[model samples]
Target: MQQTEFAFVLPQGYVDPEGNIHREGVMRLATAYDEITPMRDPRVQRNPGYLVIILLSRVITQLGSLEQVNTKMIEGLFSGDLLYLQDFYQRINQNGHSRLRVACPHCEGEFEVETVPVGE
Candidate 1:
């Protein structure tokens, strides 16, 4: 079986009320149930945008020194971090891999490179 979980470093990071900065985290590949269950959530039904929050809360197993990952914590994330997580989720689960084809600008050499969720 392939790896089901992926590690990520947030670009902006999440700052808690105590001023703790959380950058490193782990996210597991979402299952069919993981995607479906969130749709039934009242919050998602009320606001479709909230689906990402619920979906992420279910897959994010860890975030820095946080004891538990929850929707509240996810909601506190910076926009960049949230975007990173969204892309990361798709890359790992939808693509079934975290790699993409790229070409070197200078030499035009094509190669496969592991993708980082955060943008440069």
Candidate 2:
């Protein structure tokens, strides 16, 4: 079966009001609706950057211990974690894989490496 969901870990993680940290989460492939609908949101219309926040909120099915993931939760993520999730979303949705292409400067060789959380 084709994989529709992917697992990811944040670089810094989101800290909740209770001082709890959430790092691991799951992101699902974005459907046409997931991509298109966000553009119509007033927040996105006001600030294009908000599109990612809305888009991410819809596709992220789970985050650490959170029972439900929402736009507020997404907005609470640290900048580093948000960046990590953005890249992760693109890789899984656009590339159909969770990896990044890298080049070795010494030998000028190209390599594909899995993208994982730091210190993992």
Candidate 3:
């Protein structure tokens, strides 16, 4: 079977305690268990916002030079990066691609753009 992993660059990379910036990472398509299991976590019950953290931690296979991807690391990501990852996760798992529809203002032409979340 083909790999379902997708690569992404964070809008604002995660800065570790050692000051290392982690920008690029890989996230796999979320399995049924990946989505359902987190609902049982007490943290998700306490803070609904934390659902994204747990979801991303489970899907992200690698993050730059990090030895492991875990909830603590996901928690450390900048808000922008977190939002980017959430969108990315939905695009890959739900839509199966990062392409988004776009329209040209001048000619009114419609097209699709493959979005990559990255810093300006």
With a 3 Å backbone cut-off (N, CA, C), the pairs that clash in candidate 2 are none
lDDT of 2 by residue, 1-120 (tens): 888989888888888889888888889999999999988889999999999999999999988898888899899998988888898888899888787899999999999998776536
lDDT of 3 by residue, 39-118 (tens): 99999999988888999999999999999899999999889888899888988888777778899999999999988567
In model 3, the clashing pairs are none
Give residue 24's error in model 1 in angstroms: 0.2
Kindly report which residue stretches of model 3 are placed more than 4 angstroms away from their true locations once superposed: 1-3, 103-110
Candidate 1: where is the Cα deviation over 4 Å?
A: 104-109, 117-120
Best by TM-score: 1
Separately for all candidates shown, the number of backbone clashes (residues 3 or more apart, or on different chains) is 0, 0, 0
RMSD of each: 1.9, 2.1, 1.9
Q: What TM-score, over all chains together, does every model reach?
A: 0.89, 0.86, 0.87
Model 2 residue runs over 4 Å out of place are: 100-113
Q: Give the TM-score of candidate 3.
A: 0.87
Ranking according to TM-score, highest score first: 1, 3, 2
Model 1 vs. true fold: TM: 0.89
Q: After superposition, how far is residue 15 of candidate 2 from its true place, in Å?
A: 0.9
